[model samples]
Target chain A: MDRKDLKEKLLKIGDLATLPVVAYNVMQLTQNPKASAMDVGKAISQDPALTSKVLKIANSSFYGFPQKISTINNAIVILGFSNIRNIVISAGIIDAYKVEKSSAHFDRTEFWKHSLACGITSKIIASTVGLKNSEEAFIWGILHDIGKIVMDTYIHEEYSQVVQTAKEKGMLIVDAEQTYLGFNHTTVGTLVARKWNMPPALLKVIRYHHNPVLDYNSLRISSIVHLADILCRTLDLGSGGDNEIPIVNEKSWDLMNLDKQTVKTIFAEMEKEYESATAFLH
Target chain B: MNKNKGLHDKSASQDQIDIIEQKYARLKENEPMKILLNAAKEYLTEKGQEKNGS
Candidate 1:
């Protein structure tokens, strides 16, 4: 179908996959300059399941906290508004996109493992490269391939055809999607992120992750996530729906200016953090 | 006849080697991918050694 029709269909699907009310409220509260920790905590506490998940993640090895973090208010205090916001949104997105079925070619668990790996790797890359806000990088990495799931859920038959075409032709899923569906996941992902009112940087990362050089404004974050996706695939962290790795964008790679030694350090840290970060999936 | 059989076997093994090489050729050619893969290999090897030592 055309872009307009595709977006209309995806917008409908976006409505169905709305973020939980508490998660939505927390996102809004954290963005407000006047909102306090108690306000955000109170919003989160409204959803007991989300509250517990947030607390569990705060105490998990992902954060590497030595002392136990027993309450939502404490988590808010220690992690700060942005970090807490990232955690809440991550939990909310995962809950919203709960997969009900798996096909022969795609396993939902493996897809998520890949996404989580990308998130951890992106955080590490962001820190290594001295970009501010590694937490934001983590969420970007997690949500990068969200369009794939959106399509898979909303338009299963066609998406399966796209996956099948990729497998048969040994093409990247994006390319297959372009050739088959007339538009790729990036297009669909941008639409979904817009529907969620995600920030411009995030929307750009979701859209331009494959070709980060396209957007000059958010190039650094986009490039960091791009490299992270490749590294995760290299280490076999998880499957990104297809086996083939996209060629590294030469401009983006040059921008990173990562030396061999720095690359080694990043890989080592990713290996350690990935083992613990899988807790987010559970 | 034995010499011909040995030649055949060598050619068959060479074909298998070629197939394996082709599989990795894409990764080997990409400079950035090469860097990441090498680091991943070293990291995995180091982890394996650590496991064994412990």
Candidate 2:
């Protein structure tokens, strides 16, 4: 299929736009500079489930905020509007893409575990690298492989075959998709990101995560997420649909400017946070 | 920065892929993070020793 046809097929797989009403409203509210914290807070409170999850994340060890954050308003204030938006969007994405119980080969739980691991790892990397808005890195990590989920959900039969081909051929899933499906997950994910009106930073990360060539502006975020994805896969944080590892793009690695010591530190931090994070997010 | 190279190189073999797949599977079956942590530690230790030697 051509790129246009593939995107249409992906969009039709499920309601890609079916964010929870609260999440959709929160997203719209966040776009308004004049929107107050209370406005955002009120929108989030409209969904009891989202409120609980947001509060749970606020108190989770992942954030490591010292003071207790019990209320949605408090979470909105303490975590900031953007962070609250990230939390709400994450909850919304999880809801929108609720997978069936794992098939014999693919495990949805494991897939999400990988995503959570990447998010945590990316956040740590961003902070260590002195990037502003490191929390955005967390959201990027979570949404990076959204394309894979799109494929799995919409075209389970073809997706299962793709996974099998990757393993059997010792190929990356992206490569297998190119051979079988004409376009890869990155293309599908980019289209999804555009449709959802995700921020350009996030859209670039989702699009170029597999191949962080730095042609785009969000190179820093994309590179951070790229390295985080590899690290998570290396540690087997959760299955990313296939077992084969992609070659670490030398440029992407260089973009990280990580020393051996930094890698050790990052791994140490991950050790401390991985369990709590997986539990908190999952 | 290098350009987009798409997934695997043409020459990556099934055997190499299987080895990695098995290694990750074992890591998952056992303590996944533990193995990764140990790997990181060993690398640091080796780097330290190499610095001392040089």
Candidate 3:
């Protein structure tokens, strides 16, 4: 199928088309100007698992707080409605997509490890660059390669071939997907993000992470994820299907003005947090 | 950073055994990412000169 057709088809998949109902409700409430932190907290608290996960993440090393936060209401109050909303969405996404367990060519656990690493690295890079909404960068980095997952889950047989081709040619998986599938995972990922009604910045990260300059409006977040992906691959934090680390789009590298010291510091912090970060997944 | 704190709520039932195992295993096998950063710097310089010459 052509890129547009496949995207349409993938979007039609019942599971991919919508966020879980509670998450969807939270998304709607967030758009309501009158909604309070209490309102949002009550909505999320309906889901026991989500409530605990959100609380756990709020207190994690991901966000360094001075004291313990034992209740959902306290988390919502401190993190704010917008922050809590984003957290709920993140938790919802984890529940929504299940990594394909049987793909002969794919390692689902390693793939998620790579994604989790990128999310951590993206947040750190955003802070290093002094960008607002660093949490959004974390979401973007987590979902950057989501397009690959969509293809793997929905079009497993064809995607297996794409993976094989990528390994054979020593080409990046994104490039290989383009060559074999007439569209890359980035294109499919954008469709998935749109289906979930994600924020514009996130859409750009998923779509333009392979080449961030594609959308100038989302340049900052997109470039941050781009750099994070490179760092993850270089450090072997997690495998993203292929071993070849793509170039750090010189434009994005310069745009961030990254210095070695800053990167080293970020890497060290990432190492420090790595244990806690992946622990959130389980 | 609470070294003793779990990523989730303390009362939550999730185990940290997997996290501990993976952390030690990865640090030993992973490599330095500094080489890529150095290459990015070189590429930026080369691109700047290309623009100037053009």
Candidate 4:
């Protein structure tokens, strides 16, 4: 579909404009220059389900909190606005997508698991590389392939050729996308993000989330996410769209200043973490 | 930063009607974000038409 048609179409699949009211409210609260624990707490209180999920995620073993956080106010106060905002976005968006099991190829839960793994692995790489916003990296990693979810659903019957082509070439799925469909997921992802009016930084990350070299100027974030996806997929984190291993973004090594040993160590660490991460899928 | 919220949210957002019009201009180039968002946008449009056509 073309851009104009795409925009009109997405409005029907779902009206992102009418996003969960609480999420909208949270966005407003977080946008406040003087946003405080009270402001966030007051906002979160509007959505009990989201509040609980954010609180659970806040005190989650993921953050390695020393003590369990008991209240929304505490979650905001402890995790702060930036961290809380990320969690809120995750909680809201994860539930936001309308994911149904693909008839062929990918299983639904595995796809989401892949996203989660990529997110965690990206954070790991981001932290090691001293990126400014590791959590944001995690979010980007987590949602990098979200366009695939939309694509798979939109052209489930027609796009079978695209999936098969990726398998035959033994290349990253996006390579197949470029060849079979005349565009790659990164390109598609960029368009979708732009259509959604996602942050330009995010759009860049999504556009090059699979290709660091293509985006020479903004290599850091995209490269990190690109590498994290490779590492996660290498470890068989989960099936992200296509099952074949795509070529790892080699520039990621230089971009992040990672060496063979550093790569090994991070991969090993991600390996140990993966076992625990998959456990959360159910 | 123009700080246009339209630049950040989906084009369907009522606040930014022009954004979609501008995006429509670049529809076929197959820019990354467009393809991804197009899948959903197309589905919704088809679904809407089906509902209306029904």
Q: Write the per-residue lDDT of candidate 1 for residues A1-282, one digit (tens) a residue.
A: 665776577668767656678877887787688999999989999998988889989999988899999999999888888888888988887877774576767667778888989989998999888898777898899899988988888877778878887978878899998887777889888887788777777899999999998988979989999999988776667777876778788889989999777887887787689888866777
Which predicted model would earn the best TM-score?
1
Query: Of the candidates shown, which would achieve the greatest DockQ relative to the real structure?
Result: 1
lDDT of 2: 0.73
TM-score of chain A of 4: 0.82
- Whose lDDT is higher: candidate 3's or candidate 4's? 3
Model 3, B1-54: lDDT tens digits are 122453333221123223322333333232233444444334334434454564
Candidate 3, superposed: residue stretches over 4 Å from native: A1-16, A64-68, A100-102, B1-54
Q: List the residue pairs that clash in candidate 1.
A: none
Per-model interface RMSD values are 4.5, 9.2, 10.7, 16.1
DockQ of each: 0.27, 0.07, 0.05, 0.01
Residue B53 error for model 2, in Å?
26
A9-112 per-residue lDDT for model 2 (tens digits): 76685454355678778877887889999998888888888788888877887778999999999888788887889888887787677756565556677778
* TM-score against native, each model: 0.87, 0.80, 0.78, 0.71
Error of model 4, residue A60, in angstroms: 2.5
Instruction: State which candidate has the highest lDDT.
Output: 1
Please give the distance, in angstroms, between residue B10's alpha carbon in candidate 2 and its true position after superposition: 36
How far does residue A213 in candidate 1 sit from its true spot (Å)? 0.8
Answer with 1 or 3, whichever has the higher DockQ: 1
Error of 3 at A174 (Å): 0.5
For candidate 4, the clash count comes to 23
Winner by TM-score between candidate 4 and candidate 2: 2
Candidate 3 residue-wise lDDT, A1-282, digit = tens:
666775566656535455677887888788788987788888988999888888888888766777988888899888777667767876786666655464778767777788888888898899889998676677778788988776787887788888988888877899898887778888788887777777777888898898888878868778899989877765556778876666667678778987766675676666566667754566
